[model samples]
Target: MVTVILTMNLSARFTVQGSGFQSSRREKYGNVFKTHLLGRPLIRVTGAENVRKILMGEHHLVSTEWPRSTRMLLGPNTVANSIGDIHRNKRKVFSKIFSHEALESYLPKIQLVIQDTLRAWSSHPEAINVYQEAQKLTFRMAIRVLLGFSIPEEDLGHLFEVYQQFVENVFSLPVDLPFSGYRRGIQARQTLQKGLEKAIREKLQCTQGKDYSDALDILIESSKEHGKEMTMQELKDGTLELIFAAYATTASASTSLIMQLLKHPAEVMRLFTPISGGYRTVLQTFELDGFQIPKGWSVMYSIRDTHDTAPVFKDVNVFDPDRFGQARSEDKDGRFHYLPFGGGVRTCLGKHLAKLFLKVLAVELASTSRFELATRTFPRITLVPVLHPVDGLSVKFFGLDSNQNKILPETEAMLSATV
Candidate 1:
């Protein structure tokens, strides 16, 4: 009976609502439970130890496997689509782009972009949609810094629009009928590949006898150095994948960070998990919390659910970043208790870059501008396709004086009053 209800709820989430995978069933069904998604049998695991096994079991007990639409849309060349040695080699080449030296070079660029973007936002007299603007900001950074494409502003704007179409339909039905989301996603992918191919060719032609700085150059050089030169199509596919990794989740997290800041002024919010969970396919029948997860069955280890249900946290729902600080160190109770960036071998490759980008954005916003929620009430958050406020997080930005290091006195007082 429990299995039947779980199946129905899963069906509704994917087909009808197309949003939200979280449910209160964790309390009733325990951490490990069986369900189905898109006709594939799945075991949803939530507890820290349970998730630890799933993540650490990568390539041994399970392997990465996204949805059919996702695999088709992202193509087979991406790191997420590959397995075994192929995935490892790809990760090694990709690692160079996010190495400590590369990130140091990217710091100034990230800060400058955020400063300029927030400055422009402050100049606007009316409320601005933070989620929309954050996407544009992250997209520009990904193109200019990560891919090293110095295209014109108009062209960048057009590319961002097309990319949005691709992301919007990444989780769509596999049907390829006219005007279907999957059809539109395929079209958008083709358009993006064309643009990326042109850029790759230009870079390859002009980059001889020069040191590689940006991620694309590094990827090209690293691939050749590793004795596996990527084809034009592979480079193009990989570029799109990198942009997808850097742009969407970062934007979602940035918007959520801003919302948290506005709501809980002085306190830092650590639970900005835009991605609810990750998918893996069980390689063999494994006993997890007394349930036998059969071979070939898909497994989804829940990040949000684990954080919410971890026994270490005092008030799991409350916004308490300090629990992670030196005094309490709640997350230290277990290895997988807190996973904003995930863990194990398949941990996020761009984790450092994402954190640096958010840190810079936070510093720039706090130092340069005073912002307030434009809406009377905090907007409801939606957790499909990535977490984001349903209302786009409208806010008013005001530039501070050159010497001003913080918000105005009254604004600080108002924030304190709310706290």
Candidate 2:
């Protein structure tokens, strides 16, 4: 059985190549197949109904579980690592932070960050790497807008450096030998936690009566209001988790958004899946599509595969914005057909903020600049951890005049006018 599974997995990997591994596997093995990944037997499920069962099942049939490396690095207190009441409570506290009111408060800052970052990127003598810049941009948003930090430039740069280490190793092997990625990740996590603890202490001491609208303030206040005050350790874990959750996913999405924009100008809708899939640990033995999903095994629902194989979507590979329009309404064909933000209780808490950020970016990019791929061939996407270009997506930006016709070198006036 293991040999057959390995063969199937290898076949899937080779067949998919640049397209996607899971989608190709689905085509070969139907909507359900067992494959080993991250040192565990995983049943990879796709199709709307199959994925819907796993997603909607939540605590009853399955529970959220990332790899060992992720679990260890993210710690025990985060919403991603918790289950049952703990997850519920943490999510409740976080939901308030991403509320429409909170997002409204964050819009100006998000816009300012995007505007400034674009100007900086465009000022470069050569084409800027979209993925690299997007990472920096989202990191700034995470630090300044979400956590509301006002640290010195040196400290911010150091934090970002440490954070890159943390992110790079989150998906590494569980081995913690000295100088291993996991060991480095553990060390980086400690550094981040210390920084976050100091920030939390400063906030508590200096801003007791102040009116701040950032996520950290709201998180602290919301936790207290729930009558279950988070401990210093919990606060640190939560803050780090927020940063981790917000950083790479948004960066990857931002890059993917830009890529899609360049290819299909009218397809501004988020067809790119930043997160390839979500993981769940089976809590009970259940029959899915006549196959027994044994308890204690892992189940991975592929978001990208679901999107690809969805019969609701005509020309699934094509970027068609009209599919989402009222006349077509393809996404509405099924509950779980198009879940960029996932579904059920564990839906991404940052979905609203992410979409809003991308929307503002798209509007700003269209209004302020004319961008094109720096290279003749578009870069291929790497889908593990998150979806981003393998080459970091080199793009050159030129300023758009008031008429949105003439393209010139980006200048301060052109960038300032967009805001």
Candidate 3:
């Protein structure tokens, strides 16, 4: 294994040229190659200490740069590309949309989405592919919450097909070779941009009201307040950027969460038990697993890694959510690990919403049915900007009795239900 000790001014790049560029390469390198792209120079980083320093550092030493492909796909003014005061201002505006009050108000809508998805899946064949289904659920939710539009079912399917192509090739070489995945992705982005521009124009003409509850509405309101409205092109780019960033990773994490729970039945039962403390217990399990990312490197934290490492918990590789019941800061080193949403200033802004969606989805699934993974071995995995099970996770769902169902309520249920 290629474990690099944390140090200052340390930088190394691992290319995907060798056969080792697959999963094993990522596992061996750990956090050291987080920022090293296929062809770019290796960015130097130590551990959490260095990650904090670089993110908080002055622009000259650790500036956020948008790769050409990302800029072309998401546009220059998107939040991912904004910097300094501009970035901070945009975050402030976006933050209001993610407030607990706002998210609470959307609970009914979220439940409706989750219920409808489960109902649809409940009727499927014994071995239904969950990866595809999860993506559909997330994409639909994005449309409802972010775009304030209800896409037709057929159109939504087509959109996912096209979006997948675009997402898969966004990091590929920019050349527009005919029939190439990169070329197809560029085309899909253009199509999405055109659609978003039309939506922005319509949103601009509407009379603002509480009923107009979507991120686009908030963005429009904020832009007007700042006297700096986005142009049609800017709106299109920014909208697509937000949708792309928010939907994929969160959905994948949720899928992984379910898989882990089902594979480890004992853990699932412990997690759902009254004594387990439900969501709090689950959160601790997520944290105890090591995500030892080094500074300067932009590595993804594999929840699987944390779940697999035995030293972190008794029978660490086993799926025992009860292990989480005993987990305390004192048990592990002082570090609070396990990063589903990453850390630092660039951490996901939609984290609150993502967690809410995942919790709701998990509750709905766990309550309504019992599911089993059909495959003996794990399916082939792929990383197209985000991780996805290439073979699609096949699962069988059996109906559950209401008495057997456990619906864990949020701490602020009284105030939120009233709101």
Candidate 4:
């Protein structure tokens, strides 16, 4: 009967976090429970020890896995679509682009992009969706950093329209039937790939022994240096993956970050990270919290649950950035307790760059202008792929001059008081 009930709710976003899952967190179903998703029976591992083991034991115990729809979205030969040695090799090459030196080089460019974008938004003088705007900002940055092209704002906006089709179809049903979302995604992928190939060709032709300091150059250089040259197809696929990751994940987080900040207006929101969950296919029969997980069974970890429940986190739903302060240090619970950036060897490689982007954007916003929420209510958010406010939280923008560091005191107080 319990299995029947769990199976019923496993579809869609319910497996990891659907409606009413929280109420059942301590319902004696145990830490690791068997459930089904997309018609396949799987294990949902909510135990801290189980999460730690699967993450830490990446190779010996289990292999990295993703839903079929997700893999189709990420494309072939990308890190997210590969496992073990292949993933490691691609990661090594990709690391060069996200390296400290690379990110440092990218700062000035990103700042320019943000400054220009915000200035454009300031001219509107009305409520605007920060979530949608942030996607454009990140998209411009992604193109510049990944493909080594500083596209003009008009061209960038146009390109986003072209890119939007691909983005809409990523997690669609994986089938080649005509007029299907998957088919549309594949077509969009081809269109984008052709564009990337053209850019790569142009970049290569103009390389007169000059270092451009971008992902394109890094990838082109690393292909030969690592003893195994990446095929042009692989490079193109990786480029797509980079662009998607840079845009999608960060956009979602930025939307959520802004909403959270608005919620806690008086507090200094210091950091934000890509909070995600993933799949681990069991290599062999395993005992997790006394539950037998069979071979080839899908085991999904819930980052939401991990951070929401205690003895792990106190006042779980409360928004308190000071938990990481020197006095509290609440993240010291255990190794796998707080995983905003995930854990284990398969942890996100772009985490450093992501952190830098978010922190810098937050600082830029605070230092530049004072903005107020257009509405007092929180926007609806969907959690299937990433957490993002559905309506793209509207904000009234107000740009400041060089001398102005803060908004009017009354305005600031009112923003908080209304919430």
Distance from true location, Cα of 17 in model 2, Å: 3.2
- Per lDDT, what order, best first? 1, 2, 4, 3
- Per-residue alpha-carbon lDDT of candidate 3 for residues 9-34, written as tens digits (9 for 90 to 100): 21122222221242354465543343
- The TM-score-based order of candidates, best leading, equals 2, 1, 4, 3
Indicate the TM-score of model 3.
0.74
Candidate 1: regions farther than 4 A off: 1-6, 14-21, 208-212, 265-270, 402-419
The residue ranges of model 3 lying beyond 4 angstroms of the native Cα positions read 1-36, 44-46, 58-60, 202-212, 265-336, 401-419
How far off is residue 132 in model 3, in Å?
Answer: 1.3
- For each candidate in turn, give its C-alpha RMSD to the true structure in angstroms: 6.7, 4.3, 9.2, 7.0
**Candidate 4's C-alpha lDDT?**
0.69
> lDDT, candidate 1, residue 396?
92
Pairs in steric clash, model 2: none
TM-score of 1: 0.90
**Better candidate number, 2 or 3, judged by lDDT:** 2
Tens-digit per-residue lDDT, 1-419, candidate 4: 12212433356655245424633743556566667655567677765677898888787778887767667767778888788888888788888988988888776666655666666666665888987888887887788655766345476677687677788777666777999877888788888888777766677677554334777778767877888667778878878888887887888777766666676642222223344367888888766666666778788886666665536556766667777778887787688877777788877887787778878777777777667789877766555445556677898877787334332334312211211
- Write candidate 2's Cα lDDT for 324-397 as tens digits: 88998988888999998889999999999988998999988887778889999998777766777888999988
- Tell me the spans in candidate 4 whose CA falls farther than 4 Å from its real position: 1-6, 12-28, 150-155, 208-212, 265-275, 402-419
Model 4: weakest 10-residue lDDT segment is: 410-419
How much is the lDDT of residue 115 in candidate 3?
Answer: 70
How many Å off is the CA of 15 in candidate 3? 12
